[model samples]
Target: MMRLWSIKRVLLAALMLALVQSAGAAKPAAAETLTIGLIPELNVFKQMERFRPLGAYLSRETGVEIRFTILSRYGNLVESFQRDGMDGAFFGSFTGALAIEQLGVVPLARPVNLDGESTYHGVIYARKDSGIRDFADMRDKKFAFVEKATTAGYVYPLAYLRENGVESLDNHFAEYFFAGSHDATIYAVLDGKADLGASKNSVFDWVRAADPRVDAEIEVLALSGNVPSNGLCVRPDLDPGIRERLKQVLLRLHESAEGRKVLERFNALRFIETSVADYAPVYAWAERAGIDLKHYDYENR
Candidate 1:
């Protein structure tokens, strides 16, 4: 009886040890990092610096590690999303629409401006002394556009030019180039590198505020019809719970002091929930402009 009892005690101890080992092996590991991509609307350094606080806020809110990435070109942002390289993105209206149609990205939220408006216009501008008074005067002048994928910077201006009988940029302009960013486009024109340039109105306004001389030096030649605001989007396949939480955090950003600071730094009044249909105007513009949705290549430019 004593021998049998000793064997039973040893077996019980071994069983408990096995259960402990199993629990240790099953313990959860740290959360995986999520990467969010941004279009090159501004200088890369400024983009990262301005967005880092927002990324950190998201990380803390979702209990998931977050990293921000800025693509060198707008098309690269779309390519990255197609490749599943980005978990989420802050996409311009044109690129956002393309991503939605191509990759099924989910529109999450968009920023509201201080005027309580969620829409912005595209503008063509030139040096005040350039003598280019209107869109018709832009013909045969050196031109600079931000990027082909940019709605305010490229598409709107291109459509306006086409409609006004300035059909071919390559044929009409003495020289032209993609300045790669809104600031670059403005500086190109101000420095006399280009006679005319195009960019989003809000961005131009921000630049004017930063350097009052820009207002004195530059004049708006024409403005495009209203365009949808940029939007935050996520991969359709992103974890549903995480996606919902991220949307909630952005929508509620104005409700917190720290969040408000972040929003202010981004030059936004607040973030509001957005839907896929909000970008329909962009699609319509593209269709009317005869822009090839699937075959357009940003690399060859």
Candidate 2:
């Protein structure tokens, strides 16, 4: 009886040791969360809804929590990146370049339109009844611009105007206002609050789709030269594993039905890899227009 009891004790101790080892092996690594910053492309509420699905999808695929942050001003977005407040971001072409230049953010991917193209145009628009027929007609009239940092909204349009002999808004337009968003700029023109407004072609299309009457209410006065579409970017110092996973998921977002839905919400057909070279024209245009990109005050109302 004593021998049998000794054997049982040995077996019980071995089993406990094995269980302890198993628990240690099965323990999960610490959870990580990645915060992504976004500039206001739509109204605050709609912009949140637009990116929520993508953030969830990224979190699920990367096994890390993903958070979406929206900034009211473009300068704030750049500042966030500089301060390590964002792990990644979606930025407009000019702003993306700025982030790259200022923060060393790595350009990752950009969305392709439904037509399978990645380039988009900026548009100067006026109400159909406003008698603003073209860029020249904008002279001596009040103008609306989305934001100074926006490539399509401010840079490209200003470049076009300057190229055509309008030296400065102060000298040409009666006055100008920064509407702070594409939708606001459009609304300003449609409501006769401004004689002309500038925004990206995609934003104009989205507004028209949401409110069909916009097509008849507003007319395109001029189109800026083609510019690279918005792109995803990551901090240069991001974890290699997380960065790889993010790149894979974004590049493949359109392959799965669930991912496709998210893309559609952003008016994107698919996401494709892009490089810094793709945005060279944006820099060129800014220089040509004499816009001081490095020191430009985006927060100035």
Candidate 3:
């Protein structure tokens, strides 16, 4: 009887152990997908082509699928990050500030361009012969800006205009159109569709090389003070381990020949570590301009 009782108890204990092990295993692990959201700041297809290789490299390095999602506008990208749909993103300064304040997304790194600087300028541009000699000359002239969400494309230019006593587009220009991106704004000016345009100075420099018509058509009238460049960021809920790993990988990209080639496609010289604190200037600018640096609740939309 004792021997039979021992066998029964041992079997029962074994079953209990199995049940405990299964319960522990059933708990979900950290997220498997790392979704990267980007603004369609250029031709959508070209943006995808520029980033696909980097995404693949990241996936191969981390053993996690890196998915790239392009939102129609920067605002929508901010909304998605707030809702936790995106694990990370590459965002302009304005949108990145919104994500940091509203979604708790943290800035991880920024790309350094060939100039060895991580800051870009906001430039006011016009045709050399348009008689718009300076920003003040923009009065009664047609203008183009990227979407309102863009920093150099809209915010900085607007702020600069307002500070110089130009309050509204109506008060300062004969007409204004949103070209939707730095490239498009430049294009609009080159095509003679607008008398003045605003764009990222670095973008202007790079694009001018590809299409010298930009130089032949438009001249920079003014430039905003240096502004921090765009950056890679991650949602607040991201696993710290994964985030750290990503940061390490990014920082070393320019160290390898293959990595440098990938970054070169974006006109990036290298990746440098960054943090939410580094973008405080951008937040200050938005705040002074009375722009809400928070993502609108879009559950219904």
Estimated TM-score for each candidate: 0.89, 0.87, 0.85
What TM-score would you give candidate 1 relative to the actual structure?
Answer: 0.89
Quantify all predictions' global Cα lDDT against the true fold: 0.86, 0.85, 0.82
User: How accurate locally is residue 170 in candidate 2, as Cα lDDT from 0 to 100?
Assistant: 92
The lDDT leader among the candidates is 1
- When summed lDDT is taken over every stretch of 10 residues in candidate 3, the lowest stretch is 292-301
Off by over 4 Å in 2: 1-29
TM-score of model 3 (CA atoms): 0.85
Candidate 2 local distance difference test against the native:
0.85
Q: Which runs of model 1 end up more than 4 angstroms from their true locations?
A: 1-27
Give the clashing pairs for model 1.
Answer: none
Q: Tell me the number of clashing residue pairs for each predicted model.
A: 0, 0, 0
lDDT of 1 by residue, 1-301 (tens): 9999999999999999999999988999878788889999999998888788888898999898888889899988998875757898999999998888888899999899866788888988888887888766777889899999998888888888877887677888899999998988998988889989999988888788898778889888788777668888999999999999988998999999999999988888999888998988888778767787666665627
In model 1, the Cα lDDT at residue 265 comes to 85
Candidate 3: the clashing residue pairs are none
Better of 1 and 3 by TM-score: 1
Report the error of model 2 at residue 235, Å. 0.7
